[model samples]
Target chain A: MVKAIDIPFGPQHPALEEPINFTFEVEEERVVDVKIRLGYIHRGIEKLAENRTYHQNVYLVERICGICSFAHTTCYTQAVEELLGVDIPERAKYIRTIFCEMERIQNHYLWLGFTAKAMGFETLFMYTWRDREAMLEVLEMISGKRVNYGMNTIGGVRRDITGKMVERMEERLNYLEERANYYKKVCTKERSILKRTVGVGMLEPSDALNLCAVGPTLRASGIPQDVRADEPYAAYGEIPFRVVTYDGCDVASRILVRIDEIIESVKMIRRALDGMPQGPIRVKVPKNVPKGEAVSLVEAPRGEDLHYLRSDGSDRPARLKVRAPTLANLPSLRKMLKGVNIADIPIVIAGIDPCLACMERVILVDTKSKKGQAWSGEELWRYANEWYRES
Target chain B: MAALNLNRIRRRLKGRVQEVFVQRERRIFIRVAEEDLRETVKTLIRLDGFNHLATITGVDIGPAIELIYHIIYKDAVVSLKVQVPKESPVLPTITDLIPGAVFYEREIQDLLGVKFEGNSSSSLFILPDGWPDGVHPLRKEWTLGRISKKVRRLW
Candidate 1:
């Protein structure tokens, strides 16, 4: 007889970088149902945005998520600029595009390393992290900061990419391209990676659409939806790039999608550098914005990051709403979690490339005992690694 | 392409909606009533291809709470806006139509006090577990100071 057991994984788990709770109902080895509770780290950023001026909110929104800081600031500034009825300079647009793609590269590299660690491939994790540092060095060189670039402003970018910076960035991109190709080969051919990721956490293409999955998660499931391709914000309209997609509809497919996206981002950055026009980096605007509202979308590393702004002819916004890509992808995560093994849970969660800070919260509950237990995410990670080793 | 989509949306939602206005290129706003919300969404999905519900933003006006359902069709964002009175603060849930709306609806319910009827889950989504009742932080009247004071009193 199969005994039904409720296993609570994380409000603090080793597998997750941030806190989130998932209570898994397991019938033997297979998961029967899963319940997610959030709000462990909700800081109320949306309510706070309405209280700050448009200029200050640029820095404020960047704090939403460290990995996708530029994505948030870019979306926020674009909405405010639209309300102000100002078109940023051409050079600034290209500069913004370069930074956006650079951010994608760094973010994908970080995720690649983190997922490798989750799967117990320590050597691969180390290799990816070493390669990722080069990308971060280039970012720090351009923006004077490693994590939150703070490159975006209301009118345009805060800084310019000089000829020297472009040359340095090109050298880094060439190096990153080689490392990306190496990872692509390993991800496709490595026996352990293939065994762990292939056919695991399967999400049907139809389910992915109906559940509203976005970014690489949607593309990996054979849909070619991307904000940059569809909406053509910033310099994307002028630059040429392909929307990467795969038919695997599994964890392996998600990995391939992000790796291919890194290659595409590198190429796009080079193209943006080549086609960059020489002009001012910013255009001045008045303090008070006009009475208007606008919605801006940015194709963040994870998915489509959206921002809605309503201005009431004041320096401060009437309302500000941010829909991080992770929030849109959570429903799909719930769909993916059903019917997977206990060992596969961590990788499946990591497969979404979730930025819980951008979204928020997690708690675990034991239904059998009718009580909640605190299990660190790291312990769950160790358990999965050990289970895979024993198997 | 966006213009064509806008015209089709305007024509399709002409009589059913209160008003339709284009904020700019690719940004379409339709002021809809609470009763017509489901029908309008169904028409957008089944007739036109606005299958993706980008997000729902709820704002607290003085007399009523305004809900904006930002739906994406191709390149354009066709927003369906609905207003419910503050006293009642209730509207039909669209979770049956789009399953992904469950989280967004719960978020609005927790922060703005606009109850989405039939949403199923009543758990606090983004707020702390022991948050005081009837205190919607997103409403304009609940300033930072008032919220802090209320929570301090509770503690």
Candidate 2:
């Protein structure tokens, strides 16, 4: 009988941040079964939201995952606004859409560079990261912060995009569009890169749906499902852009999907800027949200972010549930990892662009008692450090 | 189109459901007894083509645990909620209908004390190792300070 051995992958690694360990059961360098352990960064944000006021929870939710901070706050605030029955102004919707698309561009660029770096395409990684600075500069210009731009609140955005800001954004987007086109060519035609990515991590379209994958990971498999196109939050209802699906269903196709999406985001941002309605940016929302529950879904840069809010006629929420995209995409990652070479694990994972910090929760199962065990984050970190040192 | 399909499902499960209403535009909420939960979701899947399982959110109400299964049908999201008594928080698993529910089920079972009858990986998934037995942090009774103190004592 061929024996399968276990390879402990990570609570810490170079390909991504956030502590997630994958226990891969391998037979002759091929991964057969996978086990996952999480919770290295669990801050109990959902529990914390219950004690804080609605206004304070906005900033709290934004910190759930820095890469998708705006998406989290937008989703949370939209749910709160719905609970309060507050209607934000039209101009605020346009500005919100612009920021969302800009964040998408910045996020997609970061993923492209990271994936390329994983594949050892260092030059392309540097190029993508360098060009990515343009989008980050635009975000900072508008919101005055790079990562966690505290622009979103209950009724609308805290910042506005002026005509000069729009002009500067247009110039940068034009440049990004040009570079995106070039990256598209490089992704598709470059021989070495193609060899590493094409057909490396294959997830069938049906499997993607069955696994309930979200965002670009689902779109790359040719599902044509997007919350922005389907639900039409913010200015997406007025803006026109493609859903950007690729049927290749491989790591290479994921690259193509993200690059194409960058172009689409640029176009949508331009549309939102040019056709922006002139009006107030926010409306006055009541301090205490009415007793009600609201569900808000937004297409985050990574995937669809869902927020479920329940308020019991008080300033603080009764329960706040944030389902980040990576959480929805984790099962799909396990499915994609099956039957692949151990060497391909990094590229396969990088393709998902997992934000483990956003979805952190620890699981400790006592094998003898078959019961759950609680361990602190500090203890988990120490355990990981010891494991690393011993290995 | 979505509303009509939802209405048809609502009509089908008229007596089985506890309460059913459209929460807002493009969102629906269905509350069902614990026994009717899986069958209700299967009926919705068959009727409205609800193939996507958005998420399963578990909340601790005083005497029971509330499980909300957000299923996506076309453009609208339909939430199916089932409440199990806190003393024996056990419910049938719908992972057979939607394979993706397995992760969320495991998570709920971990954070809350709920048990799914047929879920395969209904083990600890999101909690840290050495967590105390019979202590659920997500429950209403478990205060933030209490959980921190418990963790500190363990450390």
Candidate 3:
């Protein structure tokens, strides 16, 4: 028998800028069961691909998200290029790699700032943004815009990073490294910061793997998976970097993992500069691509971003499907969120460093109790702390 | 990456486990050999460090519905596509094995009307109240109406 115990968390809440409604049944503020409902931002991007010309779809895919605009273009462009079987020029590869790293740095900085702001650490957020501005400036210099660089095209990238620009980026990144180190300490040593994050939201390695978590979220769970190091593309194969991993497998570990990755990306950019191959930035693509499917991926700041295209020997693709990392990662939240209080939901969710969208709501109900209310952050903390203390 | 021979990964896993293809030096496919998928996945996951299964891709591939696992062990990607016949498209869910594929499986089931065996529930992911039945817009057979049927975007 279903008694009335329905609770709505949000399609809009302070913890989220985007809308998602997670309604969970409370058993003394501990979420025993959860159901997630999300479709609020599904703009039918995949269907939108069916009508657009293959060349035009690159632009369409990039608009899927502002923060990850380049990721979309890169993955889409790579898929098309693969189908056409064209070799991207060495210099174009270098340039794409450079900008790709720039995107990673900027994204990590933004996520760092967001994580800080989510935790009420306004100063840390401000500091992170202050440091991030320099990277965005460099991105604007290369692509003529702060976000959505607009340089990706089928076969090759459209822009090149000049030596002078590389020097400029290096100078800024050096300073960013310094500031990132400072923030690293704040994230690790600060009681409030550590208290809110450290062990609060945890994903055991098994659950992380079971959920097929990606990017920093997976790496934080002691999984050393980084696409750049794994399936090197866009000059990634030519570059050198470590696959950053954290054994903590908690929100704090994720923070550390992202920080470590930003540092690595900075190094990758420098390596791209040191060994950038000079050549044409664009290459000829097939007027009519062969009827076949292609799948391509890139190490986006979030995680593995995938693009699949099935061309029909026409200018337009017969089918295109994009698998954003968050799609695989959402279920992993259950492993972290449950058995904890509600207040920690926002920041802990933030800790996954989620792409601005892809929030799902889980609904839970207790058969025995008719009363219902969703978990708040404070309640979440009390429950988590109580469990930890009691144990 | 050094260890990943995308060609070998593609060859080894092809037919035995799923639909396999190599594109621009990368290998990907869907897991069809349900019984061998875990072992195949374990090998890929161990070899190339394709440590993550990014997401699942589902398409209404005409006669049979397709579900692609899209695994990333290291940099090498091994996609597992399980084709289910339209009359009764049912593939065992790997969520218990790769928990990350849960939501993706859910999304695939919701949009394409393919049933994933072993999922605990199916309360509808993208559909809404009073949504008409047998009208999955993503199906190759279904075309988008001049005005889509009150489609609400999911965040």
Q: lDDT of all the models against the reference?
A: 0.88, 0.87, 0.75
lDDT of 1 at A35: 82
| Of 2 and 3, the candidate ranking higher by lDDT | 2
lDDT of 3: 0.75
What count of clashes does model 2 give? Answer: 10
Best by DockQ: 1
Per-residue lDDT over B24-48 for candidate 2, one digit per residue giving the tens place of the 0 to 100 score: 7778888998998877887777765
Cα lDDT for residue A93, candidate 2: 92
Off by over 4 Å in 2: A358-391, B1-5, B120-123
Chain B global fold similarity (TM-score) for predicted model 2 against the true chain B: 0.91
Tell me the lDDT of model 3 at A292. Answer: 88
TM-score of 1: 0.92
Sort candidate 2 into its docking category.
medium
Q: What is candidate 2's fraction of native contacts?
A: 0.68
Q: Model 1: residues >4 Å from true position, as ranges?
A: A358-391, B1-4
On the 0 to 100 scale, the lDDT of residue B111 in model 3 is 75
Pairs of residues at least 3 apart in sequence or in different chains that clash in candidate 2:
A39-A361, A39-A362, A362-B126, A362-B127, A362-B128, A363-B127, A373-B130, A373-B131, A374-B130, A374-B131
lDDT of 3 by residue, A200-294 (tens): 78898877876777789888999777777767888887887899888987789989998988888888888888998677888867657898887
In Å, residue A86's CA in model 2 sits off its true spot by 0.3
